[model samples]
Target: MYIIFIGTGWFSYVFSLVNLDIYFSKNHWDRYTNFAELSLHILCAIGIYIGRFLRFNSWSLVTQPKHFLSILPGELIGKFPLVVIVLTIAIIAGLYALCKPLVAKSSLYRE
Candidate 1:
């Protein structure tokens, strides 16, 4: 249950990063893309933490929005959320560093 949610979050976060890169590069703002990508990663990390700890998934924004909204304010400002976001970002960044070398060396990015 929890594992599934975390897995989904991880996939969504990584894909969002790739999409963000494509978008920024296409727009010719490559210089600013890294900052934007990191920002989004931090936000997604917080979102994932909220879902994991508060039991509020993304659809809650459409279905049970009030429940989701009610908790968001406090959660976003809390020390716990900060810790979770920082830790999540660290993990994601480390994974990216590990994978980036392999990805760059591969022919996949040659296009």
Candidate 2:
């Protein structure tokens, strides 16, 4: 139980950053891209929580779409989910901010 929970948390955090890094490299910075990335992070965070707490897998979502959709609103409306989602976003944003400087520095060095 401990390992599964902790692993889910760590994997979600790193995967979000990797998604951002991939987008940053592929797409030039733009307002729309920024918004898209943020939304993606939020959704991923929420999905991670659902997977961790509800014990649902990707296949579960596909196999039981109605069941999956039904639970999402209940989860989203509650305080616990809201707090977890917000914290996840904040963590991802902070990580991006910290890494941005390093990426910029390295880009300069590459030139």
Strongest candidate by TM-score: 1
Give the number of colliding residue pairs in candidate 1: 0
Question: Which clashing pairs does model 1 show?
Answer: none
- Candidate topping lDDT: 1
For model 2, what is the error of residue 96's alpha carbon versus the real structure, in angstroms, after optimal superposition? 1.8
- lDDT for each of the candidates? 0.74, 0.71
Please state every model's RMSD to the true fold in angstroms: 3.7, 5.3
Q: Locate the minimum summed-lDDT window of 10 residues in model 2.
A: 102-111
Q: Estimate each model's TM-score.
A: 0.72, 0.62
Give the clash total for candidate 2: 0
Give the Å shift of residue 105 in candidate 1: 3.5
Residues 22-84 of candidate 1 have per-residue lDDT tens digits of: 777898989997798677667767777888988887788999888778878987897887888
Residue pairs clashing in model 2 are none
